[model samples]
Each structure stands twice: as structure tokens, then as C-alpha cells.
Target chain A: MIAKVARYILFSLWTVALATFAQAADFSGKAAVDTRFFTEPPIFAQQKDGVAYPSVMIQPEFRHDWGSGNNRLTVIPFARYDSLDKHRTHWDVREFSWLHMQKNWDLLVGVGKVFWGTTESRQLVDIINQSDLIEKFSGEEKLGQPMMNLNLPTDYGHFSLFYLPYFRERTFPSSNGRFLFDPPVRNSEGKLDGFSHWQPSFAGRWSKTFGDWDVGVAHFWGVGREPRLVPSFGQGFTHPPTGLVPIYDLIHQTSIDVQGVLGNWIWKAEAITRSGQGDRFAAAVVGFEYTKYGVFGGSKDVGFLLEYLYDGRSSFAPPTPFNNDIFSGIRVVFNDPQNTEFLFTNTVDLNTHATILGFNASRRLGEKWKIELESRFFANISATKNPFAPPKEILTGMRNDDYIQLRVVRHF
Target chain B: MKLKSLICGVLLMAAFPALAQTDEEKGYAIQAEANRRDNGYIDSMHDAVMTLKNAQGEVSTREFVVKTLEVADDGDKEMGIFHSPADVKGTAVLTFSHGTKPDDQWIYLPSLKRVKRVATVNKSGPFVGSEFAFEDISSWELDKYRYRYLRDEEIDGNDCFVVENYPVYEYSGYTKQIEWLDKKMYQPRKIEFYDRKGALLKTLTFSDYNQYLDRYWRAGKLQMDNVQNGKSTELLRKNYRFKNNFSDRDFTENALKNVR
Candidate 1:
């Protein structure tokens, strides 16, 4: 009850502060209503019924600038309420930072977000923030990380230094959610309390462009965002393996990303080497996207994408489904006033023959509204019951969780 | 006697400049003069409201801010930040134009907080659902086309030089373009684009000319009409500010991400 009161007070204070800033700053936001449909019934009895899940989300962004546009403050707060799954309802501060721009350098402080990679199949080199798995499984959504960032551009390249002061634990579905893991992660409220901590980490990157090529090299000594699942037995839990507790470890990673364009083809590659989680391992993703403009003698463009993913690590390391996979996708853009687009992708595991298919289509409703359709299907998923066979694919738990979702967003 | 004859020949050449010039040479000279007259603004910025109308007469609009920095001995660097079509707000695109080779482009998607390299070979694709193609709006360089002088023409009571420009760049949507250059401003008053099949595809007209910094000529409104599709687009520009002190750093990917 005391914690609830503190949260209420903080919410009120934040609202009051934003109201005050509205008079002099720029304010914008988006509110989205989402509905998802599962193709099959729930695999676990503890999970919610398999059918339609409705949710509503809102994100408000406020930016204030002073001192001749050299000093700036941006705040973005997001919240979602799901009708079916309580754990899926959450809140996050996407970004709240102050940026001070100078002639040769820039400084950013407070909670911020940064992205660093070029591959379309996977972001092997992007490791700044924890993934918001509850929001999406594609790892595109991230929780803001508290950081002190300094960017310097010199004659050689663009250099950026980061001092991350705090770490955010990755969000995961609760036991009653559709995408729950085998042992059900301990992510429910009050179950995973006191899991995140304030640990200082350091990172740096240097990026530059030469002719048609863009290259970036970076090094990070920090807490790894991916956590190890530790079996834990707690009160009111089943025996054998009651729940899995996440354990974040410190790691040292060095990565390089390069992208170049030739004629109609855009090539991208990202490679990373890391240690501290287990034996030192290296991973890489290389791909290219070829675009054909004015296809069918019309104002439509189609692009074909192909990428290969490879990861080398011992069995003791954190499990990943993309150990040896090939990703292929197609993107279509209809050059109409509505700005309609469609994307279809498939990731196939070379060893296990497990494939995941994804499709997304989106179009604008007008100047202020937009609609999107998204679906994901898992095929050829094998069960882990047979220990004699090769270890079951990591995505076995989600074999029955194929879903199609629709979202309508209104921007203000 | 030899010096006298040489002096007479030089004077004759100056008096009748067309006599010594071929069609290509004359066209090149005219374009070079126009380029020279429009140099040294250093940088510029403006807000643009784009209205796209389909064949059925339905219309949609978008708003953005365009910033450009002049690069000596190369094509200009440009950055555009979208403000309207609210879903696309805070999205920015940075382009570095080059000569002979394809331009380098990158787009910053605010929702993803990621910057992705855009393929520049799609120069024929429409820009944001507008009638204007990517090649039409890119920074214009002299070497991108081969010039041929056509007969003089009068447009809206203004004396204009009609010149034919054959695109030297590959994958251009147009076979050739006929540009009517205003003799006084050295700026294009009108342009007619021919499709790859050697048929007229679109016509573009520029109006409301405004001079900035006592040197640069900027058009306040531009209209493009596609003859075959029966669609049109209008680009209305406002708040033409020049010499914004924008440097190379302001046109980089880092700068694009910071464009709120």
C-alpha cells in the first residue's frame, strides 16, 4: 500500500510537470488500440484462454528547447493496458534526456536510447538497452537506459563514449501469457522484485563513411542485456522446475558493422565477439537488399532481402534460436497517396528445419491516423521430449502461439 | 599584317559569339552561366507543404522542413525532417549527393530509433506519393546530363532559352527534359519531362520567384502535372532562410537522429 501511494504521487507530479511544460514546449503523442487473435488454444492450463486479446496503449512525447536550440530536453512516457493478460500491461519511460549540442561535440544525459547496426535480419551489434519482450518478440522495442553519452567527431571518424549508470531488466511474459517459456519465467508482479541494479558500464564507438560505404567499430564493457535462466523453486510453485529466474552477467563485447551500396543492391554486415557469459564466442550476419523500381510499369517498388545468421557458442551459454539460420523477406511499397506497404519475412533454422513466418501490412488512414496488420506463424516446431534427438529448438515453447494482430493508431 | 588579322578575327569572334559555337557548346555555356550566377549561398532552409492529388481528384498533404549545405566541388548535402502526416513526424532523411556515382542516403525512423541506409538507385520512384520523382528533386549537377541548345521560347511574357537535357545518369525515369530558363534570373521557369518511351510525361511550372541574400533565386510555389496519369502535385515553400550556418556535421546521420 505504501508503494502504491508513492507511485500515485510520482504520477501526479509528472503530470503536473508536463502540464507546465506544455505552455512553452512542443508536445506530440500517439494512442493505439490493438487486438490479437491466436490460432490455437492455450498450451498451458495456467495461461489465458486462446482467442481475442484486446489492449490499448498511449505514448506522450514532450520536447523543450532553450538557448538558441543548443540545449534540449525530451520526455516520452508510454503505458499499455491489456484486457487478457495482466503481465502484458506495463509502463515505460522510453526516453527522458537533455542534449547539449556544441560546434564539435554533443552531450546527452539521463535516460536515453541508442541504436547501432545495419543488418535487416538481426541487430547483432545493437546492445544499448534491454529488449521489451512483452511488447514484441522481434526485439525492435526497447526500454530506455540511463546513460551519460558524449559524441565527438574528429578528422578520422565520429566517436561516441557512453557511461551507463543503471541497468534495466528485460521484460518477459508472465506464466499466464501465451508466449510463456517452458518453466514459466518469474516475471509476475512481486515475483521478480529487486532484480535490477545500478551498475556502471562503459562503451565507445567510432563510425565513418568512405565513398559509398559506412563502417562502425564499437567496444562495450557492460552488463549483458540477455540473461541466463536459472531454475528456481518457490512457494506455491510446482516441483521439478518451478520457475526460471533471470540472471544478468557482465560481458565484454567488440563489434563491427558495415553497409555499402552497389547499383540496386544494398549490402549490410554485422559481426560481434564477446566474452564473460561463457567461452568467448563470435557471431555475424551478412545480407543484401535488391530493389526494383517501377515494377510492372507502375509506381510500385519491390525489394528482395536475403541474410545469413551465424552464432558460435558453447551449450552452457544463453540459448538463442538463430544459431544457424537464413532469413529471406520481401518488401513492397505502393506509391499511392495512402502510403500502403507490405512486408513478408521468413526465418529458417538450417539444422532444425524450424521456420517462423511473419507478415505485416500498414496504411495511413489520413493525416493523423494509421492502421496496421501483423501476423507471425511458427512451422515445423519439434518437442523437447525426445532427449535422444538433437536438442529441441529454442522456439519449441512457442509452437502453438501463432497469432495475428491488428492495430489502429491515432497521432496527436 | 599577321597581328592585325589575328586581332580582327578575335573581334569578329566576340561580336558574333554564335558563329564560333555549336549547339552543344552554346547549351553548355548557358548552363555554366546559370550555375555561376547561382553560387555561394553557403546554406539554406525552408518549410515545404506538399499536396498530392490523384487521378480521381482526391488530395493529401504533408509538411516538412528541408535544410541544405553547399559543398564545394561536389553536390550539396541535404536533410529533411517531416512534421505532418503525424505518424511520420520526427522522421528525417539525410542525403549526400555525389557526381558520376549514386547518391548516399539514410533515413532515421523515430519509432525504431534506428537509421537505415536507403538505396539510391530508385531514382525513378515517386517521392512520398508525390508527382515529383526522386531524380526530379535531387540536387542538380551539371554533369548529370548532356545538353543541347534548342530554339528560344517565350514563357508567360518572359524571354526564355529552351534547352534539351539528356540524362547521363542511368535508371533515370525520363528520356530527356526540356527546360525553359528565365534569361534574367538564370533559373528554370518551366520544365517538360519526356518518358522513357520518348513521350511527354509531365510538365512542371515554377512561379512566385523571390531573391534572397541579393543573389539566390528561390521559387515559392511549384506545380507538377502528370499528363498520362492525370495526377498532379503542388509544392508550396515558405520562410526561405539562407546562410543558416549549417556545417558538414549538421548533415550527418548523428545530426539526423537528433532532429526532433
Candidate 2:
């Protein structure tokens, strides 16, 4: 059924392209190369620790405008490789099926990746299936694949639907005979044996602009294949004879966004609620960001944001403790498009006391090429022992990591 | 015969004040005359060039040629021009202007040999490289900006009408402007611009006014200085053809990309 739908979509897009080609002429192309280096050490075990690894990504995009109306065909081919992170080395292609834009209506159908995370605190609905870079670095064969996305606009608001047909499984090795499920067990291949069903997702977003205020509400739902649930002892209740069991069901998520700018102040806030399958566990998060332009000079802009996330249900065993995280960050951007560039961004996690700082400086060498230097710092300052540590020994130490990289990009 | 000659001489003396009165009237009469003169001067102008200077001292000039055609009751108006210097020459058409706020624009690139329409709400935004915006150059008649007589002034030995013009358009980038209009010729001699924050932004001076067709006045040179940026632009008009045999059909979207 999914394949049939994909074929139909491709057919329709081809028809539109042919029709546009018959009426109009258009030419646009852009080529870019981006390279990045990580400062922080690997957060997960079983991954190679790297000090100076470089990655480069190149993407060339092209578009043809058909004069018959506001319709266009766009294709982007991307290639990337990283010596430090081998899993990120891959080739990808994106096709924008048909973009029909009118005065009041906007419709897009395509097979590619779409980013929909609009909030800083609760990035819950950003479920686009991406390659597991961490796993890939460990010599895994799996890679990221394209997904189908559709967006429709209406008078009330917009609606988006996404689907990823293939599902990949993951496993971890532990001390107690390579624990697979909860409580210590022999490691085994996590497979989608009977569940060959494609991962179907849906999101409905509605927004209205009133004067200067924009209010929005969104909801998302997806099927959960593997669910790990641990059993625990409650007040006046004894543990079941059976060991910790796994519970699996579908996941339902909802969120609301409200943003407005008044005078010199910009305010944005988002709240997200998620319900885990089987168990009625929920998580809520809220955040706000403010931006001011031309603070010092006409070329500078500054932004600050504060966010808080409350995990009502913890993933740890037995205790099911609640966790709260607070985050604050500041960003300064210099918008001198002609020459001399400076961009600095710093984000601090107040709860765990973790912070990430980034700095980027670039200068235009000529019309087509530029040289840039960048540095990133990641630090964790939690007082409590590392949660990932074994229960036998108490853990205490701050994790510190930093990286600096330089890149030269030529554009055509 | 002596009594008849004395009566005629008295009538001639009474009518002399109406004919040879001082051009500069003070109190209420001065204000009324200035208003009438300013309106007539503004109504007579059909088109002109607007030049802008940016912070980096870069200069960009745009031509605003307006044509007035007779409509049933109200006059029908149209404007044309190219956006960029590179896009101005042969087989390229990137000129976009509309009569209303939130303008509609079209661009014709010779490379693609096609015209693209741009429909954006913020047409009052700054032009390509200059601080002047499309709203500053488009067909905005004198009636669009409310005027108030500030005081009588003299520019270059010419008595002028110094008036303040406040824009009536919504979301205007300027608060007000002071203009010096030549009293005798009714041509703008100088203008002082104030930003939305009511701070001085720029000053424009017009010179070398030549009478076109004996009845119309056109400025041959214009200079605008950005007070905040310390940059200025000097524009010299050339090859100006007024009331040419151009038709509305020539300015349509289809012809925009093919215009030479």
C-alpha cells in the first residue's frame, strides 16, 4: 500500500513538471560545503573516542521555474564524509515533488527529510527518521533513509503527515550476561519479526494571527515498536514473581505554541505533552525566547531564551523518580553580509549544569570563497553520580569536552 | 474735463495694491498664498528620479516616471522603471511598482528570458543598495502627504515655501520631512528627512532646474546625504524623454522581460 502511494505521488509530480516545462523557463543552482568537528567526548560507550576528526558535507541544489504559474521542480543531491564519525559518511538525494503556492493556499508533497521542531525545550515531535550516527560510528551497517512528507494549508491552519516505511532495531550489551531487556539477560537481536508494519505518523497544526500575536496548537501520533517497561514495588505491594517486563503500545503526543512581538520585546512559549504506550506516563515542557536587534550597532542582534522540562515518568528502574531540567542560553549574531563575520552562541543547562558554547568567525576572501574558524565546548556539571554508572559503586565527576575546527568553503 | 481726469486717477491708485502687492505676505494672507502655491506646484509634477545613499556610502538611483491618463472622474496613473543597473540594459526587465501599499512587482531577466512577479506586503522596504525604498520613489502624489506651512524661507536667493509634510500611509519609515519649494518657480529646492524615531536621517538638495516645454520644471542634478551614515549620492539625469509615445501595453508583465 505504501509503495503504491509513493508511486502515485511520483507520477503526479512528474506530470506537473512536464506541464511547467511546457510553459515556463527557470534556472537556479547552489553548491555548498560544510565541515564540522566535535569537542565533546562520546556520551555513549562502545564508540571510538576521537580528538581531531573532520567531516565534510557537500550539497548541490537546482530548481526550474515553469512560467505557466507558481510551480517549480527542485532536486538536491548531497554527499558527506567524516573521518572521526565514519557512520556519517553517506550519499543522499532529496526531491521536492510539487510546490503549488498561491495567494492563500500552499501545498507541498515530497520524499525527503523535514524538520518541524519549533521549540527549544520540548523537541518531542521531531520524529523524522534519521541515520543513527552513533551506531554507525561503531561499524554498523545501517544508514539513514528518506521519508515521505506532505503538508496542506487551509484557512484555519496547516496539517502535515509523515511516514517512514522501514524500522531499524537497536541492542545494548551489559555486565549481567549482556542485558537485552530489563533486569539482566542475554543479549539478543532486536528484530521486527512479526511487525513488518511501516511506521505511520500524523500531525495537525492550527494557527491564527491576531494583530501581532500568533497562537498555534499541534498533535502527533506514531506507532511504537519496542517498549521497555520495568516493574517496581509500590506501597503495601510486593514485587510480582515474574521479573521486570516490557510493555509496548502506540505513542500519542500533543503540544501548543504561542509567540508574539510587542514593541522591542519578542516572547515565545511552547508546551508539549506525551503519553507513553501501555503506561499513562506524560512529560511537559515550556520555554521562552527573546530577541533584540541593533542593540549595539545596526549590525548586531542578540537573543536569550529560558526553558524548563519536567519528565513526569523517569526511565530508570524501580524508583520511577521525577526529573526537572532548566536551560538558558544567549546568542549574538553579527549581520555584516559584506565583510568581517562573528557569531557566538552559548547554552547552559541549569538543572544538570551542562553547557555548550560555540563560536564562529569568517571572512570573505573573494566573491565565491570564504574561510571560517569555529570552536565548540560541551561540559556536564551534575553533582549527582552519573546515572549510567553501575549501582555497586558511586560515581562523581564532571564531564568536559571541547573542539576547534577550521574550514574553507567555495560556492558556485 | 479736469473733474473726470481726477476721478480716473483715483480709481487707478486703488487698483494698484491688488496688482503690485509685495509677494511676501505676512499673517493670514501669507499662509493662504503659500498653501495655494504648494498645491499647484505639487500637482504639476508628473515624474522624477529618487536617489538613495546607504551606510557604506553605496549609491542606488531609481527612476519614477508617472503618467496620468484621463479616467471617467478620477485620473488613472501608472509608473515604470528598472530596479538595478545591471538589470536595466537590453532584454532585461526587473522594474516593479504599484500604485497602492503592499505593492506588486515584476522582474524580467534576460538570462532566463522570463518575468517573475513579486508580491510582498513590505514594499516600503529599502531598495537594493540604498536607504530609499520603493515607496519613496513610486507614484505618490503630493496629496498623499499632509502639509503644514512652517515658515517662509529663501534658498539660493529664491524665496521659498518651507513646509512640513507628514506621510499619511500606514507603516511609513519616516515621521516627517521639511521641504523648501521655490516661491516663484514652485520647484523643490531642498528637503530634510526624519526617520520613524523622529531623528534626522538624511538631507536632499536639488539644483540645476531647467524649464521643460517652457511650462514644466525638471531638476538636472540631485544630491542626497545620509546624515547618520556620513555618505551621500549625486545623481545626474540624462536622456529624459517626457510625454513620449509609450503605451500602457508596453509596461505589462509580458513585456517586462523583453524590454530593451
Candidate 3:
């Protein structure tokens, strides 16, 4: 798969280089080396990654604009090599898109990525691309989605329409990966019933700003990015299931996100209604971030974030730990030359008392170098004997996966 | 008795036009005339190279493009797109200033393709690790400051009218600014900033004036020196383009995400 992507990237780059002799173009990228140190040993024997994972990653970007700057082509390709887990080593084309700008509207074609939502805890309204879980368990990274989007600006607001012709499956950690499930998940046996990956999907969004508030309404109908895991028996087995088989379900989702700024306080909310594999469910996340500037008479800022997450789903729906949870975080900004920042977050499940704590900090070493530290800890996660039962506790699988990562990146 | 004498002086000075104007009124008139001369360019853009030098003599450079849409009744809308310091290559910021009110600002992170609203109360903090504070770089609206005439001074052989400006907005990093406005071009030749403690903090010097559309004058180079820290920043504005006919739509948060 990586060889094929490399070939495609080479071909695209050759074509772009040959056609842009009369215009201006530039190339830039970043390379990073990281090491992850797990605080606990592997719980399952299949987790062969051990307590340490070392990896190297690179992303190079090329951009060319011509015809009075109305047309542009951007290509960004990313690759990573992980020594601990082979499945974690992969390659992806993050963005290979062409943008055409006009007076009243603009159109973008090819593979691209888009993000939406206002809440900090969870992005309920963001469904354009599949999550790259193998890259980061926090689900902040995403794969580029093949799409054609048209954006229109009017007096009322901005409207965007998308025709996504290809669907990308969510990446998952293998059994040998550190953060694996009890029974592990098999991605090769994915079942797509109503549609194939080639089938097209549709999505639209309308966004506007009124005074201090920003609002967006969007709807998506297609193959769901998330898969419902179904237990599957081995070839010779009978009763006990061997592993979980991911089943892609067709879904329809409508969501809205809103954010308002009042002085030093920013209020954010995201709500979504989705239906597909199980009964229709509604989810919401509401939060506020307040910042205190010039802390202690110094050029520093301290911000506090508090959010509430709620999910209304039946027993047959996908298992989730955030059904009823509260998330709180503290952020500090040094406001210095390096733009140093630190953020610590905690999410607590109201019913089970399970908690997930995260810490992330980053600072620039110089003009082209940066260092980042990130860690996640799980606590009070109670394991259930029957993992396949209804209303399973999902957080138990990652109970012993607390890890700290240190990454040093160099940009060119 | 002071009030009676002042009233009599005012009434008598009305017959003599030169004696009728007070220091505050004269300062305001000079600034208003300068502001009127720079009012007609609908929009403008320029590329800037900012070099920052620390007290240890270590230097770093940053490059960005800035565009501004002039508003008649309110503050201007500004957008900045970073180019160099490769890590922040595609990052952009959109700002809508409302003079005395809190400005609306948003920053776009290209890696996540996210546009996040930022708090606007940090006016005293440095901008991008530069000696210039956020308040110093923002659009200079007339209502944002109250003016008082000081004394005349000559900077680089140019006769300049000295004036003191006190920030009208709350939470300012400076107690006051002393500006040496060039008498000929109606542009500032030098500015001295006083910290909140009423001590000298930073000094800004402007040179290389260029006129656009035969009316508006823009500074081609600016250098800010921090007296307390011995740090300084030099900003070189290049490739100035004016009258671009940009509208509010081009400066929106949505536009920031698509900046290349």
C-alpha cells in the first residue's frame, strides 16, 4: 500500500513540476522523531510492542498558484515508520487538492480534509473524514477524504456543498499494538452491506456569524465513518468468539455547532442526531473557556475549560464511555518568543467513575525545531468478564495503556 | 477665580483666532487632518519581514502577508497569513477592530483545519515574540486615544509636532505614548511608549515613507526597541499594493481557513 501511494505521489509531483514552468512554486515539509514510553507492561500476550515504541515521520508539502492567483494546487504526503508495531507504520496522502477561486464562490476538488465543531471535548458535528486512530488514540488526526466541494458566499451566510465519491475506513490498532482491545479488532473482515467504498456520499453546511456568535448547521448521509463491532468466531470455533469484526453501517447525521465570545469567556456547544446501525440517538457537548490575561502581573494567560457530554443511545448502539461525562481542563500560555503552551485535561464518567487524564505541552527550540510532550492516563476503569454483553464498558480495554510520548520535529 | 479668568481669556481670544485654540484642541485638529488625508484607499496589502533580536544578540526572522480593508464608520478589518517559520506556514489570523469595544479575532491552524476564536484582552502582550505589543500594531483609530499637544521636535532633520496620547481603552500596557508627527507628511517620525508604571518601555522609529494613490502615506520600515530588556525588532514592509477593492467577505474567518 505504501509503495502504491509513493508511486502516485511521484506521478502527481512530476505532472505538477512539468506544467508549472511559467509560474512560481515552493516546497516545504517537516520531519519528526518520537519515542513513546509506556508506564505499564502489556496486559495481553498478543501486544508485542512492549513498553517502548520509537517512530519517525515526515510530511512534505508542495504548493503552486497561477493565473493571477485564482487557481492553486496543493499536495501534501505523509509517511511514518514505527519500530514497535508494523501496523502503525503506514503512509497517507493528507491533501492533494486543487482550489479555484472566483468572485462569489470557490470550488475545491480532489482529496482534502475539513474540520468542524465548537466544543473542545468532542467534535460531534465533524464527519467529513475518517479518523486516523492508529496515528493518535485521541482521534485528532484524520485521513484525507476524496471530495468535491463548492462554497458560496451570500449576504445571509456561507453555504458549502460536498460530493464525496470515496469513503476512507477508520484505521485501527492491531492486536500487537499497545492500545488494543481485549479480544482485539480485525480490520480485514470488515463488512459493508448497503454500500461499497466506491459509493458517493453527500454533505452540506451553512455557516454564519451574528454579532459575537458563530453558528453552523450541517447534514451528512452516507457510509458512517465509525464501524459497529460484531463478534466473530474462528474458522473451527463454535461458541466462544475469537475477535471482533467491524461492520460499516450506512448512516444519516444532522448536526449544529455554535460558539459565542463574551469578553474573556467563550461558550461553545455541539449537538448531533445520528441513525444507522441501531436506534436513532442524540449526543451533545456544551462547554465554556474563560481566560485570565496578565496573570500575577506578568505576561501570561491562564484559561479554564469545563464541558458536559451526554449521549442518548439504546443498549444495541455502539459502546461509548462518554454517555454521561464531565470534562475539565486547564491551559497556560507563557506568551513568550517560543509560544510555549501547556494543557491538562481530565474526563470523568459520571456513572462508572472512570477517568481519563491527558497532558500536552509544546515549545519551539529555534526557528525550525520544536519539541512536544504528550501523555494519557486511565484510572478507575473496571473490567467486565463478558466483554460481548450489552452496555459494555469500553474504557476497560485501555486501562493499562498509559503512555508518555516525546517528539522532536524539524521543519524546512 | 481661575474659571472666571479662563472664561474671560476664552471670550477675548475669540476675537484673535490664534489665541482661541487650546492645546488639546490643537492636538486633535492635527491628528484629525492626518487621519483625513489617509482615508480614501479602499484596501491595501503588504508583505512584511520581521527580524527579532534578543538581549543576547540572537536573531530570528519571520515572514507574513498582511491585508487590510478600510472601514469608514468603524475600525478596519485586518488579515495576516504567515509564510516562513515553516511550522506555522499556513497559519492565519483575522481581526475586526471596533475602536473602544473589544476586537473580534480568530486564528486558523492549518494542521487541523480549525478556526478558533481568540480572546482580545491581551493587548499588552508582545506580538509574535516581537518588541511591538498587540496594541501597538493594531489599527490606529482616532477614538482609541485622547490627544494632548506637547512640544515641537526635529527627528532626522524633519520638523515634527510632539503630542501625547493616552489610551482610552481599558487594560492598556502603556500609560501614554509620545509621538513625533512629521509636520510635512503628517506621519509619525518617532514614538516613545511609557510602561504602566510610567517608565520608559519602548521606542519606535519609522522611516522610508511612501505615498499611495497620491494621498495616503505608509511607512516602509519600522524598528521597535525595548529599553527595559534590550530587545528589539525591525519590520520591513515590502510590495505594498493599495486599492484592491477588498470587501468584508475576504476578511472573514472562512477566508482565513483557505488562505494559501
Per-residue lDDT, model 1, residue B259, is: 91
Winner by lDDT between candidate 3 and candidate 1 = 1
Error of 3 at A20 (Å): 3.7
DockQ of each: 0.79, 0.06, 0.66
Off by over 4 Å in 3: A1-23, A235-239, A387-391, B1-18
Ranking by lDDT: 1, 3, 2
Tens digit of lDDT per residue, candidate 2, span A32-146? Answer: 3444444455433533455566667665545555555556565656676656433346565544455554444445455454433334544443444332323221112122333
Predicted model with the maximum lDDT: 1
In model 3, the Cα lDDT at residue A196 comes to 83
lDDT of 3 by residue, A1-412 (tens): 9999999999999988767732566788899999999999776777874677889999988888888889988889999999877778999999999999988999999999999988898867899989898998767799999999999998899999999999888888887887766567788888786788898889999999887899999999998887887778775454556677778878899999999898889999999999986899999999999999878557778999999999997665555678999999999988777879999999999998899999999998889999999999999988757644522667666889999999999999
Q: Provide the overall lDDT of each model, using Cα atoms, as 2-decimal numbers.
A: 0.88, 0.49, 0.88
Residue-wise lDDT of candidate 1 within A114-225, one digit each (tens)?
Answer: 9999998887899998899899877778999999999998879999999998887888887788776665678542222234477778999999988788899999997888
> Which segments of candidate 1 are over 4 A away from where they belong?
A1-20, A188-196, A233-239, A386-391, B1-11
Candidate 1, residue A63: the lDDT equals 92
DockQ measured for candidate 3: 0.66
Interface quality of candidate 2 as DockQ: 0.06
- If ranked by TM-score, best first, what sequence of candidates would result? 3, 1, 2
lDDT of 1 at B43: 94
